[model samples]
Target: MTSRVLIAVTHLLGVGHLARAAALARGLAAAGNEVTLISGGAPAPLVAMDGVRLVQLPPVHIVGTAFSALLGSDGAPAGDTIMEERRRLMMEAVAGLRPDVVITELFPFGRRVLADEFLALAGAARALVPRAAILSSVRDVLVVPSKPGRLEEAHARLLALYDGVLVHGDAAVLPLERSWPVAAEIAPLLHYTGYIDDRPVTPAGEGADGAGEIVVSGGGSAASLPLFRAALGAARSVAGHRWRLLVGRGVPEEAFAALAGEAPAHMTVERARADFPALLARAALSVSQAGYNTVIDIVRARVRAVVVPFEAGRETEQRLRAESLAEAGVWPFAVVPEAGLSAQALAQAVTQTLARPLPPGAAIDRDGVAASVALVACFAQARCRRFPALSRALDEVAAGGGSVALWWRDDDAVAPTPALDRLLSLAAKHALPVAIAAIPAHATQALADRLAGEPLASVLVHGLSHANHAPEGEKKAEFGPHRPLAALCKDAAEGLRRAGETFGAPLLPVFVPPWNRVSDDLAAQLAACGFAGLSAAGKATRPDARRARGLAIAHTHIDPIDWHGGGGLLPLAEIDDRAALAVRARAAAGGEIVLGLLTHHLAQDEATWAFCDDLLAFLLDHPAVVRADARRLFREAGEEEAWCAA
Candidate 1:
């Protein structure tokens, strides 16, 4: 379905709001939705998009009581001329184009710069368009207002105007209440979408260019002067390695005046330019202000930094952000507070940062972005389903020693044809029910048709898709630095969803990633996607329900050998021994041990069936041993239901 989206962005105090909106626009556009970025104030150059249209009004600025007339760098004050022109254009565009969705950024909650304009836009959109979905995009953190009641008023305005609020963070991690004191009432309008961003970290190769141990100095050409001077003064004392400083907007004019004279012969200082990540990737160390966006890039690029947090007085956004980042282990390198950006202080911090080894990098859940995309796609499809809520009972048929199921070859397998009687006899005795590993395109619909309404152990849509093997050490398609990985996963998810509709079961969102191998980045990506759980390589940490893939998976450990397997079967003796050890391990753990199963119908033999009997005998003797559905165990354990109710 095509969607017409209008995104309004205002950056009164910082660029976060605008930046996030830009990222959302990219995602929306990539999904083939028409997106228009409406600028109410100056936004960063980084938020530009290809397919999305950029519409700008004559920019306005806030100055004391009401807004002062804004100028286009001419310095002369222009009256209602610009405002009238912009208002006329804006209403005309809204009435004429009539967008399907109007997303206002930060006005109702954070930015009051363009509150009037956005409110006008909203009124115009509703009166003319009638069917537009009104949304407000906000950051995870909201600065606590000095006068306690201001936020409540702002939130009320938001509640009155916007249909929904898209918060780009998890409520479990940083709940709205943490920032806004009155979060309970606001909960109804909130939609916690994981952070949406497209900026790529600089590749490791770029940092190696222009050798001589480098350091970067950047803070909007206005505040960087002191750091530059301090860095220059420090270079005079530090000997050995040559120092090259990439000066940002902060350097004082005089700091560069004596760069040649103040610095040792080997050290070089140059004026700042963009492409900071590239320099950071190569730099030995950096002494910089703690801007949230820059800090993320610094951590991603693996640069050792001495954080001289910009102190906006009692407003400690930068200071708090830097401290929290270090605590999170992002910048393990070091931190130098705002007051300590002086010559000796900066030089000392720089020396320490350079001497110290770079911090162990943050694991990227390559699957995080992909899984999030898939989750959104699922939500979109669910949105379209239009069916009133419905529930179906789960079927269960127990066998001896807990539960056991087996299956023999079906027509899809490349095997000899079996007569009806022989197949029925074997299936009746050995395979209690069906367990099909439904591979998409080649597998799902077939399994659904073959076993429609039949009792089955489980029918799983495996790993989004079966196409395996990836470059850059990623064994799963859902994870990797692959171009547009989100798009790929979303497509695959759509396919799996169709399979679920056909089978009428949960259809297993469990990710049997082609190879049991998954990179940390991939795992994190899946967690953000709202996957119920991921049956991947490691244990998952759960705060509430479950963590999916690697990051979102609730209770990480479980396997029944009932998972995907090759045609090869374990010898009877080996299977017995493996089961024996598994039994002992479960007894030791004292509760229940989950073992993933790998059943292959194509390779069913007497030896395999016999091994199952032996394991059953052992399981029966150990009264503590329990058989569990991996999905069920995960859900029950993740929500901490027993503990929470108490």
Candidate 2:
């Protein structure tokens, strides 16, 4: 069935809100949904909402950050006539379409002025034959209301009208609670869909024309004149790199013309270019406002940026975003707050940003449009079957004060294969860290060199040799009781030493026995062999789970592979049941133990890969979960114990 969606958006000052909503509308349409976008704000110059039924209401705009006076299209202060007309048209659209989903952009939180229109629209949609799913679409940062009872009012409306809240930002970067005071009250309804990037970016290239140039920009330019002026002043002192300022279209043409005329001979000033993402890719440094669209563009371009936020009046949104974006680690961004925004400060920020290396493309979830549409569809259908079960499982784990930890144990890694490359690619896709269990005797120098370069990859000793030295009619065992105790210890010690020598610091001295069958006596010899941890399948039988020969004993709870059943992935139900049980165990244990996932890349089939892909994606997206390699797990354990002792 084709789902119909209605989106309501009103941008009073800047065009970012409309742009974001339009992008989502277009995305829903592309996903085979009939979409109608009702825009109440004035027509923006370049904003496009194609492929959707566009309905324009009486234009209204706010005068400055005061948001006190609403101006109409005729440039006169709007009265009840414009407000009543806007509400009427909005209501008419909702009543006509009776959409399956209703999305209101920034209502009740940031756009209190449009409460009448949105509230009425929500009420009408709810009264339809089939109640429409209502979603409150909000950006990462919201303007905290100063007036008393504002938050309570927003909370009340959300509790009453909205089915869910779609937060278009990565929670790891900026969660809803940073600026909004009622985050806890509405926690159950909020879903972070990562940052939305509407513009396509060109990959970073070498020796492009704009390389080594300082590129600066203001997102909409209404509040960016100061930043542009300060950038020009800073350019004069920074003599090494070429400086180019792309003034935004939101600045009055006369203002831009005046600034362009006063540009230094060494600097270039022009209106914002369509190739801004490409420009950032080639440029050595980026200077811009901390708007949502511009920040995502900078991150996509993977350039070092200095963000000078626009903080006019009581607007603290950009300032908060600047600081949080820098802290997010998706990219390198320096913040020059309005309090310290000057020629000297801009120059210093530019110099500092340039001193650092350009950051790599972020591994964040940038598929916000698709995720949002899925969420809307799920809520509309009143079914949880539309999305991944793993996602729901993660939400539960996060809500329960527990976390999921995943690690890969690829056995018999003598050299890299196309399959190994594919496995690592999947790991990178989910930003999941891996602990490669290398057979020390069979591990090649080339494999060690490759693992050395991967920042997220760590080396672990699989065994002295993968060869089984068991007696006749016995099961395969390398580090098992079948081997002599002294000889086995020597072999383990040699494997640890060789791995450390080959991979250097990247090698985490963790022993992963072949067949997951290490003898109890041999397990005690790990730390004496310089191993910091031992990872194996199944629960530990040791009474004291911590501090085994100065090593942490972490065992895998789920091995999706059905080893006895042709080495394919086990049934999803079985894997999930095992994982859930392990998570419950950890929660009962006060969240102290790490939940591990064991995998052998060499033995994986197509089904195995798919299971891993879905499973890891969910775990990495979870807020409470922390991805760690064997090295990080042991280090964190040591730190926690030290803290307890202190």
Candidate 3:
């Protein structure tokens, strides 16, 4: 259950992306997973990195709002050398860790400039022996691209390479569709994980350092320099109030010193504080840009605030967030547009915000860190629900110079239906063979024609008429003991004859009993009736006696349908438990054991179909599991001579 997770995040302007990724890494690590966070941004001293493996690449950041151009650590254009080093380090981490899950933060959504490295990392993940689940991590809101086809390109890349996208905000509060144009196209893969607020809550009056003071912050970047300068001028005008300005580290030393020097006697300007959230707890009013993390802190503090969103260089993420929250009345704030922001406007907004009473705390989801951690963990495991256990067992078998054989069987096939098409498509998709049990009385030539095109599909006779012959008090079965021996044997021979006539070349000489139940006398006569093999549910019983009578047994061990309970698909955990037990038993027996997956195509719902598709693809992709078709399985079961003769 302990998965190894690798999170890749790069921040070009602000540290919000890195900060969110770090929080996620910590949450996963706390859940007993091995977490490695690779950051490709300028390091921020305030971001927590406890209980995580931190990998820093040659960092590159953009100056001001010039996102098209990247600057190296020396503040010059990032040349080929730095970009190459970054890509090399990224691929190295992916190769070295061989993670079970790879989370690319904001790629294929907002980081088109760094597509080369992200695409390469995704390719490496796909090439792993057991492929890693690739996921995209994005904030609640995004900057909608104005250029033609950019959104389409992101959508295409997501469909091609990603398994899921974690939207870190609650849909009820703010859905991705509010900002993303193609949200509907990728809706199936989006998981809304509340909001990622990991800051510890501090009680009111606890923040003595900022009690009754005006707090101003611009997040952890120099992009907030305009906001700081505006707030400085506003502080001089707004008298009789203690003011605190927190300058981010990304601001140049001279810029920070200038703000501090120009502060009035009532104001204090310093570097961004680690306890900003704590400061907000007691501050009378908060003045800051409407970044995701900042808004979360303000919401937790329940403080009346003024928001000056950073809208430079066509940046609309913060502006959209501020407007949405304000419109919903979720957080008490007044927005001061950055276009015409000045000392007078900021002072008026700050005074108005302080005048309003604190709005009652809105009931919104704020458990996003924990929710995201649980979601990612489940996403990683669910990508291959039963595969890890089966893979491990197969690994041990291979280590001991053994191997595993797997076969697929779907019952209740009468004619060519959409369900049958889906089953056949799954088989062809993985190039794995499937044994379809068709009722001979109802089997049609159309079904045979369909199978002719699908070489991997073969037909097995599923009883004479698939009509229950058992007494009403007992379980339903077609070939139960209530029937006479001669009558049952005659029906068996007739069923095989009908199946052979219907499906000439694709027919396998196998008997599949309805409800997997047949009388002992009837089972004993299958080989004599030219069955060559008996297919049933559960493990093969009386193998020696059947083999002496020249009848091979290939029993299906896994069934995903809950026929006895509601007739819907069983929970994935139950199916995985069954599979784990089967695989472990096979490994312990120390031989090439064939594990069969049983399904009912006609009875399958969307959930069942999806599960079967994933299961089949996983078994086919595994290196140690051999896909055994019906003919091959029966031949391996000591019916080679019978198959050859037929």
Q: After superposition on all CA atoms, how large is the RMSD of candidate 2?
A: 23.6
Better of 1 and 3 by lDDT: 3
> Could you give me the TM-score of model 1 versus the true structure?
0.51
Clashing pairs in 2: none
lDDT of 1 by residue, 1-646 (tens): 6666777775433344555677677777887877788765553454557687887767554322222334432334535676676667777767665776777776677555455677788767644312355677766556665666778668656544555677665454445565566554456567777545466766656436644365655544345555666767777767655677665422346656666457667677676554666767767676677664566567666777877766643445566656655565545746677675677877787777777765575543222223333433443332211111100000111212333211111221211224322333333443333234455555545445545544434454455455554666544454334536565456446645655676666355544454444444444455344344444433212112233333223222222233235433332233434433433333333333343334444445433443333333233223433444443543443322211000
Model 3 over residues 143-187: C-alpha lDDT tens digits?
977789998778767755677898999889789888887554367
Q: What's the residue-level lDDT of 23 in candidate 1?
A: 69
- The local distance difference test score of model 1 is 0.51
Candidate 2 or 1, higher TM-score: 2
lDDT of 2 by residue, 1-646 (tens): 5798999999887778888999899888988899999998877656667789999999887655758678897879888998899889988898788898999999878688777778889878865644677789999899877889888778767755666799998887688788886555368678898777766768777788677799988876367888888988899889899988887666889999888888888789887776778898888888988888888888788888889877888778887887776666676678888888899999998988788765663477677988888887887665222123444555677787777666556666779888878878867766677788888888888888877778778888888878888888888888889877898899899898887777787787788888778877777777787888877775522211534556776667768788777776565556666676666555555545467777788888765675565566446545767876766676655422211000
Better of 1 and 2 by lDDT: 2
Candidate 2 clashes: the total is 0
- CA lDDT, every model vs. true structure: 0.51, 0.76, 0.82
Model 2 segments more than 4 A misplaced: 183-185, 205-211, 360-362, 383-646
Candidate 3: list runs displaced more than 4 Å: 384-617, 621-626, 629-646
What are the C-alpha RMSDs, in order, of all predicted structures?
Answer: 24.7, 23.6, 10.9
